[model samples]
Target: MKLKELEQLKNEGVDHISSIERRRFLKLGFLVTGVYLGGKALSLAPLTEAQAAEVVPPKGKYSYSPHYSMVIRERLCINCELCVEACNGTNDVPSYGYRTDILERRRAIVDDKYETIFMPVLCNHCNRPPCVRVCPTTATWKDETTGIVKMNPGRCIGCKTCMTACPYNARYFKEEGRFVDKCNFCYDTLLSKGAKETACVTACPADVRVFGDLADTNSRVYELLHTPETLVWVLRPKTGALPNVYYTNA
Candidate 1:
């Protein structure tokens, strides 16, 4: 359905799916699971003579976190800030306290070698998240499937426990509001479970951010984790949250 049609249906209260709907979907899990994976592999596989095809390999990436966090691909990044802009437009995140911010740092290597590097910083959506522990109220929780940490503004007491707990400085408190918020990695966008990628990923000019699963051994994110060049660095490791964000070393 088109966006307008979907919104109209929602207004008409057609959004609710009852137990029968849920159970019916559950019953087809095995069959649906195979079809989905098989179809994807087929799409990615080389075309046969009988196959009608034109486009080369479909462009984009996937995540497999079991609720895994979003992956950022640094090499593909040109620091365009489309992710930041998309984020601001999507969540209305404050102008200064960005849910995603670009950070630039200069490092001097041995002797005189020096270079300036820029990286986009945001919530790492960690496992063993310290923000969860420091919360005065249980407002932040990690999703099981995507590993994206989310906020419950209604539950937050605005104590700022989470803000202090993050090592990457990914947490932020709104200036006009007394609530904590961070990236949920576009959960609403990924529901279709198809070639459709996240807004930030799609908006990316350099296509640097790769969103997918961290747990599945065969997933791109998973393979990235094992790559010899991959580097997961905390802005300050001493702070807390064992972040899921990583940078590939060239």
Candidate 2:
């Protein structure tokens, strides 16, 4: 049912609670089945040749967990397309929006210099995931031990409230589908066997990303995430999603 039509029904004094609920479902359904359905197709490709490589992060407490703990290595990423191909290939994204998302901010340089730096964006796998809080159905979840946010398409009522609830804009819906989707730290590829890293971290030509645990001080991911020398940022902190994704100079 259309939003306008729903409103019309409400205006007509139709006290149908089911209609209101159905309207809510349709709002989210459009995002999955309508707008971004082609994202996976845009990302269709083969995994990187170095898909099996492992990262040796600096020593820290969380080193033992070996989850794909997302870290934006500010210095190493040159905005190259290698990781893009790597992610699409690994996931068969089936749409242009595969696993990788590039972030660009316009900046003006001195003496009329102007340029923009491209940074890849994806799910940060926050400790306190807002996406989990807003789902009408219990579709999105965060693992306590791994610190990775996960999705269940089976439980998703095609409601995308999680998308708007997220400040990082990490949650994405597919075109002509009926479910919301986003990066789950590549749990399917890198962590399925309980491995220690992700394809994106392994395939990065410049080694800009890091993976590990957030709680263990012994883990490399945790140390890098906390160190002052290395920059770590959550996208749109003002929005208060408390995103776990961290970025250096970017």
Whole-model lDDT, candidate 1?
0.64
Per-model TM-score, in order, reads 0.63, 0.67
State the lDDT of candidate 2 residue by residue for 138-182, as single tens digits. Answer: 788776556578887778887678888776677667654557878
How many pairs collide in each candidate, listed in order? 13, 32
Per-residue lDDT for 77-163 in model 1, tens only? 667788889888867778878778887778898889987677777777665567875676779876655666778888888888788
Deviation from native of the Cα of residue 159 in model 2, angstroms: 1.5
Residue runs of model 2 more than 4 Å from their true location after superposition: 1-68, 175-177, 228-230
State the lDDT at 145 in candidate 2: 55
Q: Residue 248 in candidate 1 has what lDDT?
A: 57
Quantify all predictions' global Cα lDDT against the true fold.
0.64, 0.66
Residue 95 lDDT (model 1): 80
C-alpha RMSD by candidate, in order: 19.9, 14.2
